[model samples]
Target: MALNVALLRASFEVVATANPRFVHRFYEVLFERYPQTRPMFPASGMARQEEMLTGALIAVLDHLEDAPWLTETLGALGAKHVGYGVTREMYDWVGASLLATLAEVAGSAWTPELNAAWTEAYGAIVSLMLARAAT
Candidate 1:
């Protein structure tokens, strides 16, 4: 399925503007819901991790239409993640946490359309990452 780029960008921008703690909220939800994943991250240096995630999200959104670049980048990223002990199942948990965080941040602005847009976008991203991780 195709991603709703416009909706994704607009909603992301709104969320970013509305919540300065976007990434923090994501980690909070993630750890709260999937405590098993908590050990994967360090207690300190989380600011750097959060920064990386924000950068990655921006890059993915910016290059959503660039399949070749997305594949190559995410492929390498996926392979790297494998080294970091990221299991394929963790992606689903992350996706759920991401959507939950976004919905929470977006508050009244969140809608069914935004949820579907992010769902499709995250699914595509994970599919690429997993495909390369399997290699």
Candidate 2:
């Protein structure tokens, strides 16, 4: 399925503007829902991790139309995950937590359409990541 790039960008802007701690909330929701994933992260506080995630989200949303860049970036990222010990299954948990956090942060701006847009975008991202990971 194609991603609703416009909706994804607009909804992400709304969430980012509404809550500056969007990635923090995502990690909180992820850890809360799937405590086992916590060990995969650093305990020194999540500042760096949060920054990386926020940058990645913005990069993906901003470049949704650029397939070559997306493939190169996400492919390398997926390959890097192997060193981090990220399982293919963790992508699903991360996607769920991210969408839930976005919904909560977007508040009144959140819609079923927006949810589907994000879901589709995330699925495409995970597919690229996992395909590279398997290599």
Candidate 3:
């Protein structure tokens, strides 16, 4: 869990270093592939878009010390997203696309350590969220 937190922090640092062009590229690639997610975002701008991504990175990193807290937070996040028409299936798409973007940005710097950490972290996130949905 600590490693997962470190990875989230490290990945966000890499992402934050990117120019705005990279953000646009990421959104473009994601939305183009899954047009259905477009409506979940602001139709007119990227303000909330940046917040959501940045917030998720920070939240995940900040909560690594407490897996239960991470699970709870992600459950709330999932519930909110559900209101936006984001289904459980959609989370899988989000994970894939976000990881792809990270890999693209990190290039050679993306190692097994980071990959495994993020994978485990995201798994926990999704599991808790789905568990919440069942409740």
Candidate 4:
């Protein structure tokens, strides 16, 4: 299914004001659900990682129509992840954690449709990442 960009963007805006907490919640869920992945990140770089994640989300959302830029940027990010020992399987864990965090942050605003949209978007991103990794 195609991404519901408008819905995803609107839902994101609803939780944008709580970005810091959202990012924190994301990592909290991710680590809690998949403790094995925790070793991949350093304790000292969480703040910077949060900033980069938020920035990357905004960049991806804003430039969703720019396929070339998105592909290059996300591919580069995927290539970088290869050096960090990120496996393709980890993408599923991250995606689930992300959706859970979004639901927690969005509270009553979260719906099945919104969840599906984000899932689709995340799948697209992971596909790009995996594609890059395969090269």
lDDT of 3: 0.73
lDDT of model 3, residue 72: 78
Greater TM-score among 2 and 3 belongs to: 2
The window of 10 residues in a row where model 3 has the poorest summed lDDT is 16-25
Clashes of 3: 0
lDDT by residue for model 4 (1-135), tens? 256778878898988865646887798899999999998998677988888898999898887777888789889899888989999889899999999999888888889989888988999988877778863
Q: Write out the backbone clash pairs for model 3.
A: none
Candidate 1 clashes: the total is 0
lDDT of 2 by residue, 1-135 (tens): 367777788888899899999899999999999999999999976999999999998898888999999999999999999889899888899999999999999988899999988888899999888778973
- Determine the backbone clash count of candidate 4: 0
Instruction: Report lDDT per candidate.
Output: 0.91, 0.89, 0.73, 0.86
TM per candidate comes to 0.96, 0.96, 0.81, 0.93
- Collision pairs in model 1: none
User: Which of candidates 2 and 4 is the stronger one according to TM-score?
Assistant: 2
Show where candidate 1 strays beyond 4 Å.
none
Q: What is the model-wide C-alpha lDDT for candidate 1?
A: 0.91
The window of 10 residues in a row where model 2 has the poorest summed lDDT is 1-10
Name the better of 2 and 4 by lDDT. Answer: 2
TM-score of 1: 0.96
